[model samples]
Target: MTKISVIVPVYNVEELLPKCLDSLVNQAFDDYEVIVVNDGSPDNSQKIIDEYYKKYPNIIKPLKKENGGLSSARNYGLKYATGEYVLYVDSDDYVSSDILEKMYSLGMRDNSDIVVCRSYAFSNNNLEKIDNEILNNDVFKRYILNRPSATCKLIKKEILLHSELAFFEGHYYEDIAEVPAFCLYAKNISFIDDYLYYYLVREGSIMHNKKYSDKLNDIFDSIDNLTNIFINKNAFDEYKDELEFIYIKHLLHAASLRFLPYEEGLPSINKVCEIMKEMFPNWSKNKYYKKMGFKYKIVCSLIYKRKFNLLKKILKVN
Candidate 1:
């Protein structure tokens, strides 16, 4: 079997598609295939995809489907993947060529089902490497607790298949719903400290688009789906602490911060807090909550206390 299948879900990224494709084709590794799935982009993305496929037919495996959003495109690409392992890449972003070679090697050596590499956040002309100290199975809960996005991670395709997992289609913040469940299914994991993924932080991306702030409601569905997934697997209590942290981090704190920015954001923030109250009412006693930095503790406290005005003012001041 091929070492890896790099899944690139393409959308309307005509201008940036070449850089993403170029990065993959020039990888130092050769035992991988790039599954570039175009999601009916209205831009010139398909033409660019076709040109690249023509140039490197063996390496570039192209799949064209209707516009079904990122999650749908990923599910489509994954359905036909023929690799022992899978790695996801966004067409608007790129990755270090050495990523697959290094990650794949470690995955095989350790027989780890999930391999993580640090990601570089690029904006304007600056590149900031983001991540913490190296991790392993010792910190397994951390995997499900942090960095919910599945982008750039090398995962065993069997885990996805056996788990019968698919990204929650048509939902915003699908990563929140999907990534933790994937991590839960991982029996072994590995991490690389190197910045192997380039994450483009551009304006108008899904997370940054404030005009669609109402869509933050989708995060609720994502969180709820995760809860159901855990229950179905009957692994809820085994990872209950991590699950609580997911609710606190993704729904309460992260969503509140997003809503705190706008004029009518208080109601949204309130909605997030209400969910936390209903689901994880004793969440303040969470172990990870005790380990959070002073600033985050303050933020969580304010949110828990339902202090919307004070929380907004405090966040705005910073």
Candidate 2:
């Protein structure tokens, strides 16, 4: 029988980790092991991990490591995993009881390298389900042209090994870079329509930090890394536009935040524009770029400087 390894990276999610673990502990499938890596969390996360380890010793293996961020924690967990397939679960997120059974069954039955399912986000008062079309569409192209999150997917361990793929350590947007490449290398994929994962949206999370302001060069640097991977793989020409569009959208969001006035923001915005010109010089002619209008342009113009008060007067950021 094939086994699945669930890699969950633990951090300072003491408040929500219990619910996440409870859901996993009760999974309908039994041929699985949960590899929990504690990424130097300062809270009571260690205590919780210890409790679970004692209760489910055979299924749960706990490893304590220094703070190395998300990518590092995942890489650490990968080494201890013994399952034929792997699924990544965030410490603050939970999964449906049947998620493992369904994902594993589908992957093995269909001989697929990747198995993807629908997921939803739970906030204070809202729940948003990701579109179901992902499981039905051409996953590789959709993945390249759209939002690609790894949490809702099950991947074959061999593919990662064959491709020598590991999450880029020390990076904030590792998934935003790695998941697509993994899919591009995939030969077969299976899709399940069920909402198998529950992603918690919490403030103070690394992804939600407002301090992740736009560093124009860094942003371009990351995009270039992914683009080069795709181009070298001999992916379609369509990827160039898709990659550029993705960066442009990121730039737009970073620029639009409530911050200092245009004067402060303009430098970053101008820097983004410079990168965009280098990546997609014809972006101005693209319908989406043209539709951004003056509001977006103004926000970009004020990315970094000492004009906070002026920025607030014009936009309701955050």
TM-score of each: 0.94, 0.82
lDDT of 1 at 79: 88
Q: For each candidate, what is the lDDT?
A: 0.85, 0.73
For residues 1-318, could you state the per-residue lDDT of candidate 2 as single tens digits? 238999999999898888988998899998899999999999999999999999999788899999998888988888888888999999999999999999988988999888988898898868899652422155565655445566888998877664436776776567666777787678887777789898888876534555544432244455556777778778747566556556656554553342223345555555665666566676545544455569765554444332445656767543
Question: Which segments of model 2 are wrong by more than 4 Å?
Answer: 132-137, 162-164, 210-218, 236-238, 252-266, 284-315
lDDT of 1 at 20: 95
List of clashing residue pairs for candidate 1: none
lDDT of 1 by residue, 171-245 (tens): 889888888788667888887778899999988865676564667778888888899998998989988988998
